[model samples]
Target chain A: MRGFLVLRVVAKLLMPFMLLFALYVQFHGDFSPGGGFQAGVIFAATVIFYALIFGLPAARQLVPEALVETMVALGVLVYAGVGVAGLLLGGNYLDYFVLAHSPVHGQERGIFWVEVGVAITVSGVMLKIFYMFAGRQRSAEDE
Target chain B: MAALTLGIALQRNLYAVVVLSGVYSFLMATALVALDAVDVAMTEASVGAGVSTVLLLGALYLCGGEEAKPLTRPWLPLVIALVIAGALVYGTLGLPAFSDPMAPIHTHVVPRYLHDALKETGVPNVVTAVLASYRGYDTLGETTVVFTAGAGVIALLRRIRRRKDGEQEAP
Candidate 1:
């Protein structure tokens, strides 16, 4: 596989486009038929594709396990923080109306941040699962 | 689709089953698109077809490529499945027709959500407004679940790596 020139070349060429599409899906979600979940999976798929072509170690180097774990926790914190911000601002839990000067702008801003949180958590979870399963088999074979 | 299901059911090869499952997910996504659930279709296509297939293939690498023979007789499980299927079919008989305007859902808070979503939330996508604004708590919970799952996997797998490192150090 390391010597497979065609696969290496094609995967390198396609990875950037896949990532760009994932970002597009993430940002355009409010207007389109995609959102955090779909975008997260697309992002994870790009990493998985990279892992397939370049090997697990390379993928691990690109996104270490510690960072992935942080992403998972950070995303939840971001989401909960937004809710607490609402509470601190004299609104109910998870309330977005009080997030800005205008209720509508506040809602939009809250939703956008919430979607970002969801995307990060979803991608982290997907990558964690992939790394777990893939790493387990490799370690098992080593023994 | 029926043929694909039959082929999946009849096949003993786990690899073939994984491939067929991916195909089935793609078909399900197509069906969702036809039903005007584009968001759900996108999710199905990405999670079901892309990620799930890769995960299953990774799992298959660790497990046997072929499914093992069942230890017990199949008739009792078959009867249970048929009974549940029959009950599900019977339950559907009491449901409203497709796109029934007078349905309970259509008559409920959905109408309000649809009418005032844009005005109140300033989000043009009603689904987004409802999911992120109206039901923000639920979305937060869902994100927490994803976080917990990742944490749980790390807890489970990290111990193995720690043990391996200890073993190497001892040797």
Candidate 2:
């Protein structure tokens, strides 16, 4: 429908701004209703809108299925890797104080990395679910 | 029958029925949000409104569209519903007031999360601090849930290869 087309166009135009806003929310989450999860969901939703309008094949080509799966695993690895790094540094598991000599700064650094992992994993999982459902079709030729 | 049940009974269109079910879920999500359970609200919105409807439509495509006849005898269902309602009401009597400051939950670990999280964890959002750090193990479990769901779907659809082999064997 014409309306759906227009909405898709608007969503396409709005994506970059939405992503920027999501970053803003992520960084300012300490003081706001938005946090890593909400920002990640918003990020995934934007990509989903693209898939919905343009078709799953186009979206998959842009962000491949295999890559998404790898990213999901990678995110968890990165998160737990940080914890292991802490252990090696003579701190408890996930204790970020030893991430650097300055405990507060180290905590900040660790939190930032952890949030990055969350964003990647959450977005990947969300997109993977969308792909599973939206990509199903009667024929591959239709795609 | 209730209006919702009647609506399902009368509706012939699969898409419309799905939309109605989505509407029902949205209503339930709104109720959860009003109850101040933001996590449940988020899960309901994503799983109920977004994913489940899509899955149902996909299954409909595979199985073909046909409405099953409504149950003639509602006695067992009515009994189950009444028992559930009674249990829920009984549980409600033991619950703290919605926003009670004196609630044991508010006085305990929750207060630690709300107050000391920013100072201790250097994270602004207390929920994130709790979910990702203070209780990261639980978050790991949540991530595993997603993994399991993905694997489950793949398992369900992985029969195509076996089916093709069976066809060849038959010929």
Candidate 3:
């Protein structure tokens, strides 16, 4: 708390790269050593870092509580919706082979959307949990 | 690794225990890398070592910094733990050697996945192909599980917050 200036400056310097690296991990998952889960966690960690430095209210303004809850639901819907699309296309549930013009493209497209869904849900849940815990302590103090 | 676990077990201070547990997670992540499970390693390093520690520290803040010393000698729990450990170690002896290509799992659906994942799924990473394409339903189920857990926590907290508000209004 004493050296607030140093912490703030360093956090500002680090956050963009952290977010970028998270994106890299998210997209490069098909070829490398990361995926939705890791990327989502890293993204959440960056935001949590900002919250720690700037305060929870600032973080909440940046990512509103309502939006976070919607994200948790929306990601699941996106994931399940892809499966329903597959079923409508005459494939079985979650069958990606018929998603596009060819099986290869379809598979890629399906995987991409699925991973995106995973990342969204994971990140939203992480931030939501953090907010609950941190917010609980704050409200207790306010009382 | 054993040393870290020992330290965590022996540490009387709750804060030190939390930090040591995180260190153990980091070490587990490193070991996963050596095993060539890079994706899992990344998950462990980030989720286990990073986020869990912060959450635990938040919990500690609510509770207190120091652990309350248990007065009773924990003989029964210790014995149960020892028995469970022994059973687990015994169970491991039945597993095939590490990376044994001829193992039942490697010879099973894994062959089909390894051979056809890239050709059929258009993904270079077999793990991604398996998780998102071949086993898409399972992944969907897992995502739903995550959603439910988050919702559960949120619902629980919201009620308490509302109750608190009601009390304040009563005043």
Maximum-lDDT candidate: 3
Regions of candidate 2 where Cα sits further than 4 Å from its true position: A1-8, A138-143, B1-14, B24-47, B51-66, B70-74, B161-171
In model 2 chain B, the worst 10-residue window by lDDT is: B156-165
Per-prediction TM-score: 0.94, 0.80, 0.96
Q: lDDT per residue, candidate 3, A1-143, as tens digits?
A: 43699899999999999999999999999999788888989999999889989999989998999999898998899899889999999898898888999999999999998999999999999999999999998987886
Q: Can you list the residue pairs that collide in candidate 2?
A: A30-B124
lDDT of 1 by residue, A34-111 (tens): 778788889999999999899999999999989887888888888888889989999998889999999989898888
List, residue by residue over B5-96, the lDDT tens digit for candidate 3.
Answer: 99988888999999999999999999999999999999999999999999999989888988779899899999999999999999999999
Better model by DockQ, 1 or 2?
1
DockQ of candidates 1 onward, in order?
A: 0.78, 0.36, 0.87
lDDT for position A130 in model 1: 97
Q: lDDT per residue, candidate 1, B1-171, as tens digits?
A: 899999998999999999999999999999999999998999999999999999999999988799998898699988999999999999999999988999998998998998999888888878778888898889888888888888888888788688787876634
Of candidates 2 and 1, the better by TM-score: 1
Clashes of each: 0, 1, 0
Off by over 4 Å in 3: A1-3, B168-171
Q: List the residue pairs that clash in candidate 3.
A: none
Model 1 residue B166 distance off true place after TM-score fit, in angstroms: 7.1
